[model samples]
Target: MFFAGDIGGTKVNLALCEVHDGRITTQFLRRYSSAQFGSLSDVLVRYVKEIGPLSGKIEGTCFGVPGPVLNGRCHTVNLPWTPDSAEIARDLAQVVEAGPVQLINDLEATAYGIGLLQKSGQGLSILRAATGAIGHRANQALLAPGTGLGEAMLLWDGIRHVISPSEGGHADFGPQDEEQIELLRWLWPRHKHVSWEHVASGPALHRLYRFLKETGRETEPAELAEALAQPGVDASPVIAAMAIRGQYPICVRAFDLWLFFVGAEAGNLALKSLSLGGIFIGGGIIPNVLELFRRPAFFAGLDSKGRMSSVVAGMPVYGIVDPLTALYGAAFSAAHSHGVLHGFR
Candidate 1:
């Protein structure tokens, strides 16, 4: 058995998986609120205790953390806790004596998971071009907008694909039109340097909603307004749901603008990486609001580059529907490190 986790700002998902002949099967899984736990080690300890003793049965462990990993430790970008792989290994040794404990950036894990899915013929249904030809050895990109924006790339290195983590989501936001310029100006006072993540993530939905409301672009319905005013309320999901249902004009517009920025940044990533293999969109938000992304405007923003429009136009794009992408990736990483799986290198 191998242990894997997808640790994020909002929640943490942990699982015990078994790999047989390069295929992974989850033996147990659980989700916990990250805010409720004092640290990742606490959550892992509780999980192991609850799962009963399996001393020396587990081989390796891997975690996909929502931050940059350095020297076996990660200071999470959005969370207050810092988890060290070596510390985790020490803690787990008390119960299972697991082998090498690895920590990787969450987006890197997502890219690896997508590569595994593609190899297994279980990747998201392709958004193919007219010619139905996707570049086999070209680089691939993964961009996810959740609590924060995440970016990663998979480079074809002659024999196999290699996952590389990036903090590109924090790069400066470039406005393409007059309206976006206005939005940038609106955001300028609040943030000295606005990034694509500031305007395109889950929190950005609430930010966009506030901008529209304060500017009197649209009147918020009384019911929705009350819900948003509630203490500790997260308006992002509510706004996205209303937009998808077409219940409010402001919510609809906010969702559209969010997608526009997401598409634009995705296009920018494509150009920067030459990701002809494909662009995979994954996140808690994308899988929920896929309908909004299917609109023509999303594609319009994606292919809006002046001179290089045709290049991106032919590139196939896909939305990852699977929520366990990072979890699977962590498992793959653990198994590969222990020489249990050879499919992913």
Candidate 2:
């Protein structure tokens, strides 16, 4: 059995996978609220207790965290927890004599997961561009927007793709039009350093909703207002649902702007990576509001690069609909580490 996890700020996904002849099958999977746990070890302990003992049956384990990982340790960016692979390995040794416990940046894991999916020809749903257009030796780029935006690149070396993590999500937010300039000015004073993540992530959706209401550009409907005002309520989902139903103009507008920013950042990543292979869009938000991405405004944002418009236009684009990509990646990496899966080195 291989242990794998996708550790994020909002939730933590853990799974036990079985690998046979390079094929991975999940034997057990569970998701826990990250905020409810004090540390990653606590969650792991609970998971091990919940599942029956596997003593010495585990071969290896891998975890993907949303932050920079160095020397098997990482202080997660969005969570109040620090995860160390050495400590985790030692702790799990009591339950199972597991092999090396590996920790990797979440985006790096996602890129690996994408490559694994492409190779297996299973559990991958393509939303755009022609299938199989991404050549085996071509470079690939990944852009995802969740609690925060994530960026990564897969550099193809004759036989395999190398994962490269990026902090490009924190890069400056560039305005494309006068209205965006005004919006930047509005956000500037509140945040001294405005980034694309500030205007494109899940929290950005709430920020946009609040901005429109405060600026008197749009009025929140009574029902939506009440829903947002509820205790412990998250307005992003409600707003997205309203927009999808076309029941609220403000929600629709906010969703549209969100897609525009996302598309622009995706295009920027494509240019920087020269990802003629393809640009894969993956995130919790993309699958929910995918229809909006097909709108003309989104394509306009993606194709708006001044002289490089032609270059980006020819590049294939795709949306990853599978939510378990990170989990799959963590499992694949663990299997590869043990030589159970080949051709990924």
The most accurate candidate by TM-score is 1
Per-model TM values vs. the true structure:
0.95, 0.95
Task: Kindly report which residue stretches of model 1 are placed more than 4 angstroms away from their true locations once superposed.
Answer: 128-132, 343-345
Error of 1 at 264 (Å): 0.7
Best by lDDT: 1
Model 1: C-alpha RMSD to truth?
Answer: 1.6
- CA-lDDT, candidates in order: 0.86, 0.84
Tens digit of per-residue lDDT, candidate 1, span 19-116: 87778878768999999989889999889888886643778889999999999999787888899998998988786667789999999889878877
For model 1 the local lDDT of residue 326 reads 91
What is the per-residue lDDT of model 2 for residues 138-223, given as tens digits with 9 covering 90 to 100? Answer: 88789988888889998887678888999899999999898789889899999999999998888898888787888888988888
